[model samples]
Structure formats: C-alpha cells, structure tokens
Target: MTAISVQNMNVWFGTGALRADAVLDVSFDVNEGEIFGLVGESGSGKSTILRAMVGLVPTWSGTMQIAGETLGKKRSQAFFGNVQMVFQDPYASLHPRHTVDRVLSEVMRLHGIADVDERIVQLLDDVGLGAGFRFRYPHQLSGGQRQRVAIARALAPKPTILLLDEPTSALDVSVQAEILNLLADLQQSQGLTYIMVSHDLGVVGHLCKRIAVMKDGEFVEVLSVEAMRRLEASHAYTKHLLASSIQSVS
Candidate 1:
C-alpha cells in the first residue's frame, strides 16, 4: 500500500520576472510502514517536497495523496490528524513558555480526545522520558532531551505518516545514534510510514530502504543501498557527497 504518492510536483516562489523554481516535476511513492529517504544538499528542494505533501507549500502544482485521499492547501480535519511533522530544530519547534505536559495536552484537547492522561504517560515512556519530566519547561531539558520531547509531541496524535526533516542534525554523534535507534524501534513497533528529508547519507543508509538523491530541484538519482555503495567516480557529485559523509564518520 502506498501511503503517499506525488506526481509532477513543482513549487515556484515568484511569477513572471522573479519566478524561481524550488522543486520541479518531483514524483515518488512512499510505501506503507517503509522509510523513504529524500537526500540532498541545502536548497535542493527536499524540504519543499515534504511541505508540498503536507499541503504547506500551496503554490505547488501537482498531485499529492496521503492515505488514499488527495491533499491541498488548507487540508480537511481528517488530513490534519493523519499526517504530522517533526522539524529539524527542536529548539524552535517547541514552545518556550509551555510545560511539556501543557504542550502535549493542547493537541489532545484540540482534537477533543477524552481520557488522555494515560495516553500521555504512555507516550512519555515510549519516547524514553519518565513521567517526572512531563512538568518541565523546554529550557529545563538538554538538546537531546528536548528533541525527544518534540518526537513525543509528534507521536501524541498517533499519526500514521511522519515527515522528519533532518530530525537528528542538531544532536551530538552519540545522541544521534540513540535517536536513530529509537526511531527505528518505534517504526517497527507501530508500523509507521516515514518520509525523511536529510543530507546525511549514513543516516539514510541506516534507516531508509530506498533513497532519492536530489540536485538542482530534481531527483538526479534513485537507487538502493547496494547500488549506492557500488557507485564509481563517474558520478562526480554523488561520489563527493558519499566520500565526505564517510569521512565525517571516520
């Protein structure tokens, strides 16, 4: 089952003289419960692709479907509940004044969900946070802990599809590994479908079953991990990126 499908998607910021293309003719399908990686450098439109799918980039002209229902700007109430996003910056994503308890509860209240106390506690434990931390403010936690809170908030609604944009980019090496392992474990347990936008090849290699490499607002290559590992010097840009990412680990 395809959880999301995109066809001929293009996003333009301006019209006429100032027209600029952010994404061009992007197309792909995300299988149910599978992690699909969109890997590319900054300004390559990977993030734009995600925004389009979730109906945030309304200027786009294309076809996008989530869970068999097509999407558009100002999504219906049902669309909002089915899809959720975990942004790159945990610091910016969470509210400063709100306690973690208030943060998670707001969503449940908005959706008119009853009996949320037990659900919130279970969510905290699932994200590796104890109930003790639930009352703390965003400033009270470390960077990694803050990210776990962000993940918990995203999962609070029990969304079927998650749009993860460089979810581990701001974390330390050890913290990154822990978050990655947690995401893998969560996906396996819940059968979640993930569309991850990242520049880290190693991260993609570890989590995604298939990857699409974007360049100049287009997908220049889509290949399996085995094919990427066998890439030659002929693919100058791909080779450079792969080598740089490998060196980053070493």
Candidate 2:
C-alpha cells in the first residue's frame, strides 16, 4: 500500500512578475514503511515538497495524498496525529523553557491521548532517554540528546509517517550515526514510513533504498542506493552531485 502520493506538485512564492517557484511539477509515491530521500543543495526545492505535504506552504498547487487522505489548504486534526515532522536543528525546534516532560505532555494533551504519564515515560525510553532527563530543559542536554528529545516529541503523537528535513545535519559526526541507527530501529519497530530530505547521500543511503535528485525546483532523476554507490547516474547534475559527495569525504 502507498503511504504517500504526490502528483504534479508545485510550490511558489510571490505573485505575477515577482513570483518564484520553489518546487515545480514534482511527483512521487512512497510505499508503506519505505524511506524516500530527496537530495540537493540549498534553494533546490528539496525541503519545499515536505513543507507542502505538511501544509506549511499555503501557496502550493497539486494533489497530495498522505496517510490515505487527500490534502486541502488546511490539514485535519487526524492528519497531524498520523504524521509528524522532525526538523534539522533540535535546539531550535524545541522550546528552551519547556522541560522534557512538559513538552511531551503538551503534545499528548493536544492529541487527546490517555495516560500521559505512562506514555511520556515510554516515549522517553523509546528515544533512548533515561528517567532522570525527563524534567530537564533543552539547554541542559547535549546536541545528540536534544535531537533524541525532538524525536521523542515527534513520536509523542504516535505518528505512522515522519517528515525528516536533514534530521542529523546539525549534530556532530560522532553522534550522527547513533541517531541514524536509532531512526532505523524505530522505523522497523513501529512500521513507520519516512520522507527524508538531505544533502548527504551517505546518510540518505543508510536509511533510504531510493532517492530523487532535485535541481532548480525539478527532479533530475530518481535512482536506487545501489546505483548511487556504483556512481551510476543518468544526468550530468546528478553526476556532479555524486562526485561532490565523494570528494568531500576523500
């Protein structure tokens, strides 16, 4: 079954002569429990698609079906409960004044979930947090720990689909693998589907079987992780990106 379906989606800003297109005529489908990757540099319209899907960008045009519902200008309450997003910067995503417990509790409250206390404990554990960190502020935790809390908060609503926008990009290289491992484990355990946008093919390949290469607000190509590893690309831009990724590490 398909978890997400997008057809000829276009997102733009401004109007008339001043208009700028962020994403143009993009379409893709993600199967249940699959991790789909979108890779490109800044202003490549990679993140615009995710924002459109979650209804963050109101000036979008096209069909978006997620979690079995056709999207409209506004997202329903059930849609939010079924899908959640984890942003790139953990510290910026979370409130400094809110404790871990308070943050998780508030989400659960808004979702009308029962047994908030027990669920909070379980979510913390699921994100690899200890009981001692429950009442701590975002400033009190390390980068990785703060990201774990962000993951925990996204999971607080018990979503089946996750929108990850460069989830580990802000973290140290040491903890990136740890967070990636945690995400992979969580997906397998919870049977969750993910749409991940990242510039790092290595990170994307770790969690995604297939990826779409976006450039100038359009998809240049979609390729498998195996082909990417073999450095086989159909487009010149993709070849350049693959080469860039390789040279950065070597």
Best candidate (score: lDDT):
2
Off by over 4 Å in 1: 232-235
Model 1 C-alpha lDDT versus the unseen true structure:
0.88
With a 3 Å backbone cut-off (N, CA, C), the pairs that clash in candidate 1 are none
In order, the Cα lDDT scores of the candidates are 0.88, 0.94
Distance from true location, Cα of 65 in model 2, Å: 0.5
Residue 124, model 2: Cα distance from true site in angstroms: 0.6
Shift of residue 90 alpha carbon in model 2, Å: 0.9
Candidate 1 lDDT over residue span 78-125, tens digit each: 677788889899999999999999999998777667778988898899
- List TM-score per model, in order: 0.95, 0.98
Off by over 4 Å in 2: none
Q: Least accurate stretch of 10 residues (summed lDDT) in model 1?
A: 227-236
